[model samples]
Target: MGSNAPSSAAQLAARAELQGFVQVTDSRAPLYARLAVGLADDTEAVSLLAAAPASARIPVTLFAAIHDLLLADPSEPLAAWYPNLVATPRTDDPVPAARELCRRRRDDLLALVTTRVPQTNELGRSAVLLLALAALGDEMGPLALLDAGASAGINLIPDRLRVDYDGHQVGPGPLALTCGVRGKAKADRLPSAVPVVADRRGLDLRPVDLGDPEQVRWLEACVWPDQTDRFDRLRLAVAEVRRTGVVVQRGDVITDLPAALAQLRSGHPVVTTSWVLNYVGEDGQRAFSAVIDDLGRDRDLTVVNYEEPDLTPGLDWSAELATESLSVLRVLRWRAGERSVEYLATGHPHGYWFSWLD
Candidate 1:
């Protein structure tokens, strides 16, 4: 989570410089605006927000992502992405203005990158998927879980908040999964996992520590304003992390997988991630899958992912851009040579969706 208060003038400058690059890529601006705010770097963002007051309506967390995206690679789509944002309608708050800009530029960027990258990882998908994994373990016992792009480790605390499905209920709170399942199933089998035993952890290139109030707020600001449950879930997750402490190491996922696995019990099932792998390039994807494959061959392993099902690389302008609805969530389970997959849900990467997997 780092310090929400930008650490120094130099750090703020670096973050702003990163935002400048992200804004160039229409896909990156909404997030860039938020990260610029979160890192406490965007004075223009702050000033704009103060005047517009649309900050509450904005997806502020995207800014941090924009910072990361630009810092990682600053060419191609981003150059066009930034200006697209400038063309978007400006609201009272800098955040929404930034988000609208991203939305406006999404089509152009989608054409630019085609569908090579995934756009979002909303908490609703993560919540259901984790519950499903826990239920799957009801058949195989509990497992050790590792997440990539964990961003403050919020998803790791899925058990801490409440989840409901139709008439079924689960969680430390009362929230439930509302998506309709294909077949009639017994609600009794749903997970009633005690928050205590879930061995959860994650790795993020920029791991956000939830212990800090300011950092937590920035994460809070990232949630869309319309979803009250999402906000509640995020708050519960932060509280859980603060109370129980989470194992979120600050490092690259590829380099850290081996060590992360070493910490898990040998027989415990290993679940990799949800909506985090898409940011990685081809080589990194292969290396990561290879690591997971090796783990499955030698150790108990399962991969639960909620990523865009389509990987079509060419430019597809016909597809709708800007919203997270384009992304589909899928789960992968490993066993020897078999790679089992099930489509679970779909929505904005960070927006809302129904889950049929539970």
Candidate 2:
């Protein structure tokens, strides 16, 4: 039987047993995330967190520490584990063996109720660019668009709202945006062509169906708590998505991509995911790149990737702590044989940015 219900004592016992679980390094996540998850009542967060593999349990344990030390006793030094946690190096790690006995307990925790969440990650860039295209080109007219890694049909609703980019803005409009940098972008004043949106479809091997309320709610909770802007953006995006009939289907892109590409209208622009690429691993990235290289040469495609540029170790765990989103994201624009530079931005889960790609 699945462990989908646990008494309060069972939960506390589990936490106590795993008390030794501590953050090894602050490199992977920020203190706030640690605090939010670690210290916040596990009775409240455990259900959602339990969905993650046991290998992820220690992170949850350390998260509890953040709550205990920061919230419960702010004046007390977190010295016992702070520096050690931040300085410890990362390697292939796993949850302590003790977790195996908590299987049923973990299952029980995952059954909690959650909020409705929309599509997230770099796939969000596809819609962001469409707005940029209209805002920059001075056209709101319908534009043909396509997306890869369309996890759920949700991202297919990119054209339904107004957007503000780095201050200079546009939209179906009135969308408010705040940025960390200055210099108002030259945007949206012109009568932008109304996008005669001919098409918007996506491909994903394991596409999530937003139509399912429980699953959608789980997706919402999966969203990092600190990024409230993301929550708002998702709210707007989902509202539009609910009104549309955009479709997504199950299929491996490596084998089915050419066929999917064939469905796009000629001369129309295509956009794919920055977040999906990170999950593609080494060979998958090369193969996908090769496919795009061949297809992009003859098509008017703009692949906007809001992804990490390299595998180098250092990263801003602070933003991760704050928003549960990547703070520093490199935007890559690839078309034909050439790739041009776009500025890096601190990303939000919902599509807001503090920086710009200029």
Candidate 3:
């Protein structure tokens, strides 16, 4: 290979931004990431982070490998590196372990980070979706769900997770997920039971298979090392999936949606997505909307997304919370050439917490 490009200031700025994100929302993963970022200039870390292909979250994948190593062997060197991990967490500088892994497994690490997308189907995010479903409980009952970019389709089983809000609570499943309401969302709380989901299916370019150990291993690898709560929830969620697997197909969302829609068994059709539209360009986003619109010509369609306003048109509000920087989400219903938009909540990227708004 020719002379590799030098680390750029832009990449460093991004790393700084990511560090801030982890510092606020995460605990242990940030430590290892900080160490890796500090050492970026010395190695090809900057090049590796900056030169990522489409859908590949380089930083998440990079740390995921380190996290997996720690999980793979909860022993010295790696064991003490991340204290926040559920299996082994000890407060200590993980720089040495991170450096050693990067040095010894450079080629392997690069391959994992470059080839794979940071696909995480966290149980925490289910709260955000649940809140939206709660809001639409009366209007759409016994719902049929179609999730775009639904990796592993873990989220397709919303009814399986439990949520406890201020005055209302939903579900009593094995996960029993938790989410608190903030700001105006407190008033927007729904009835105890969200609209029961009739059936659910997901669309992904590369859908993960929980049956395959390799695929499941990659899913575990995508999780932040310190988020033991999510890790524990994911285990149950995966088990739930095994007991009742969801249908996640390998195809383009826009191209495959019509066919997928045709196969629905019953209930009103609702399309959902979160942290997905940002990856697509403006044209693709508009095309997706257009497809939904096309479908809306004859039948009713409901859409919801947690999205950054920069890419999603008509969603022109920012979170008042100065500390948190994440996508603003809302619920939309399209029918008879008309669309209705409503604010859902502002939340952490992983749905750790939600500030509900009307």
Candidate 4:
């Protein structure tokens, strides 16, 4: 019985994490919020979550796993409550049905929670990336984008998607992404036209293959079910990516930086990382910085990082910014062996909105 005490304690901790997630989640994602609340009190659910690696033992990962199952088979009773599955989600409690599914599909859920990592590949973030690219293009001319940790490389083609920045539109697209503009940034600041993409390449440890339905389903599962618009946009982005194939080399971003940079033949090389550094640890982040600095010795280079302020090293931005849900958009440029860092903007982690800083 004493040996079981540690496991029991771990379940309690995992349950607490779920309760906390419910507090911070957007009020609009009521279904997930409610599930988190219910799952917090479910012994079986908490135990399943506790079995996952400490880093993967989060409400989002667990919920996404369940979402993936539903996406594959929405015939379950709980599917009726998922907005992505049904046009009108029932208002009644979904916890009972959710619990039943967890009990019946324990082994499947366990496999997913233990192995899968959440990969949002949020297309909304394309707005943030596009803005940064345009700013760089104003000075650098055409740019070759090298995406670090670019899952499926959806962001590799932001110029191909239509982005409406408060009535200002960019891209000729199949997918339209909208970001609310705030603060001092002006639409006129963007280039008269979208930046010319000399080339686009991506480096990821495990890049998603758009051709695989299961792989694509996991990407969709990562999105909250209540955000139907995000789910729809993801579908459009996937179609666009399928139409224009992207090359995502399977390699570590830190060690493979130079090789990836070599693939770009012309135009300024711009490397972008979004929500990727958090997984790389502090040492990896430092190494990535070192690699960029080393490569910049002979030529001009730029790195645009959209990451949590604290997770991103070498920048002295306020600690307060890290505490907020917002992610910072920072641009680092190397000219003549000199490095300069600029804090460009702050925005929603998913890039639904942003407040630019001059």
Candidate 5:
């Protein structure tokens, strides 16, 4: 089974690109990236991560997630090495340290990534939703949000979070996500307030329940180990969700689209998919696009879509997708049979900051 491995070199390369991208954009994540890159020739690491390629193709995300789990659980030995535990961590070459940690707990770590998908429920990205809602203008009146691949469905309630784009503020709400404005973002018209979300619902193949301690732990695991601020944000989002529960159903997005759309009660129904479509096959994605288009033909449906340019079709986007192979945020609308898709911003997968694309 050495040469007949399930995870092809291309899958490993995708993990590399994701790691390299994160290594550059986020200072805290470089350590994890280094460990991921170290696995290029390390047989143990490769075999451990790609035990089941279908689930492990995106090893970097999965690995980071498990680290989140181990780090949070004080009983795990790796938790001692976790930088967050001690204010001043032993930061001298984290790759070797990481390898040692994995070597020590090979079975447990292997078991974690083999089953878990790259489930990052980043509620911080709700800022992008606010931007999309603002782009629609007040004429759309109230909003009805339908989130695909919504994970824990915390992102469905972006209005409940505050967003700040380089001091251009939005929402006097619960959570605050501040992003540095860059490139065309400085010139583009940003949102001053969170849109009025009258109603919301989310669809995920495996919807995570925040009320469940185990699910909450896995969600925490999905977050990168280095990003303390993100972890804090996750805690806040979890609390909010527990306080006011969200409606997230577990079902196939393609098959569930009709029923999901039918559930929208009032106001302009806006469908938003952020980083979720990447998991769907090309055929599935085409079908997903077609479904939205077909629905738009009859009613006024606005779709806010964001995905990695590499994952999107007909995406002759900007330098981020072309050069860096990054995530691009887009705002699209179909009203009275007229449709428009616009690239609004490009940012890290975890929403550190976004360059507004005018």
Candidate 6:
């Protein structure tokens, strides 16, 4: 019989990655933490993860693939532990069930991780986006939004969704998002009115078609299994997008930006990128900046970036504020060929909360 076991080095690397994920994950997500610990020592599971591309070898991608499978077939024993799949998740140890599912569905899991990268248009971040938009509107009036790396363009509609920043509410829509405010930000500092989004467009290499059920399910699967609130919000946001359609064009952020910008005819153009520059590497990030700088020569423009501090180039504070755990929210603007930047706030990657800095 042919042996399919992974090499010792591969197994060691996978174990280290899973262990690191457990350490960094929020304490509330106990299920994933436990699952990662259990799978770290499992040779077969680690082997499957080893076969995936370097970028997709992390715990999030592995668990998301499993979650995708569970969403399709909730009959699996592992589904009992997932709050999204069960009315009341079982408190019993779920490692055995998870291992069994991994053993039985090894092929399926491998295919998913090999083919798909974890994609999330995290709606929670809209709270931060809304805040940024309010600041821009205060200075420049109504805005045109162009989202780079917009997975499903769901975030392109922050203006239509309600966000309660520690009791201060914004927006008049049905889907409500709660974001905790910290630091110098006060309730009165929030804009009295939500900024009007005159035009909204998104650029993604492969945009999710909400019209397709599978694509919708994939988006749902990307949510952490323990965060049931996020899952519920995602469903609501998806529905809102369906009711009122969005336009997400197929294109690259660097190459096709000018054409996409040309399509927007109203308001001052504001480019927004949330956790996207990291995927492009240092050179690509520099290239993207050059593109924006070149474009700003003829028109007044603004860029709002919610990304890892180290990954974003040209931001003066990126080196000083770099941290693995938080995302920095910064704004870059150009007028009459002169450039300026605003370091707005730093927050959780998912926008669960933020600490404002003047």
lDDT of each: 0.51, 0.45, 0.69, 0.84, 0.71, 0.84
What are the per-model C-alpha RMSD values against the true structure?
A: 13.1, 11.8, 4.6, 3.0, 4.7, 2.7
Clashes of each: 32, 31, 3, 0, 1, 0
TM-score of 6: 0.91
Q: Write the per-residue lDDT of candidate 2 for residues 145-190, one digit (tens) a residue.
A: 5556776655554455454444444446323333323244434332
Measured by TM-score, the strongest candidate is 6
Tens digit per residue, CA lDDT, model 1, 1-358: 2334445444444445444544553543454444444423434333222222222212233343332333234442432344322343333344444444445444432232221121232456655565456655665665566777777766665555565555555666533434333344545545676333348777887676666554554465444332445656666556666676777887676778777767765335555465666567656666776777676776546776655534421212124421334555455667665666555545445434343433
Query: For model 2, what is the alpha-carbon lDDT of residue 95?
Result: 24
Error of 2 at 38 (Å): 5.2
Sliding window of 10 residues with minimal summed lDDT for model 5: 314-323
Per-residue C-alpha lDDT of model 3 across residues 213-304, encoded as one tens digit per residue? 76787788677656667777787888897776688888777778888887778878888888777666667777787788788877888887
| Cα TM-score per model | 0.57, 0.58, 0.81, 0.91, 0.80, 0.91
Question: Model 4, 61-101: lDDT tens per residue?
Answer: 88988998999999978899998899888999999998998
For model 3, where is the 10-residue window of minimal lDDT?
Answer: 314-323
Give the Å shift of residue 16 in candidate 1: 17
lDDT of 6 by residue, 1-358 (tens): 1243346675667767887888877686889999998887777778777777886778888888889999999998899999888999999889899889889999999888888888888998888877788888888988999998888888888677788888888889777989898787666767566788899899999889899887888899999888899999999999987776778899998999989989998988999999888888777888889899999988899999888866665434545576534788888999988888887888888899998876
Deviation (Å) of 269 in candidate 1: 2.8
Q: Give a tens-digit lDDT track for model 5, residues 1-358.
A: 4653336665465445444655564666755655566654455566566564564466665466457557556666446455555566555555565566667777777677666666678876777656677666465878888898888887887767778788777777788788766676553477766677788888999999876777778777767667778888888888886666678888877789879988989868988888888778677777888888889999898888767868755334455455445667877678799988777777777666777665
Candidate 1 segments exceeding 4 Å error:
1-122, 172-198, 226-228, 311-327, 336-339, 342-351, 355-358
lDDT for residue 110 in candidate 1, whole number 0-100: 29
Ranking by lDDT: 4, 6, 5, 3, 1, 2
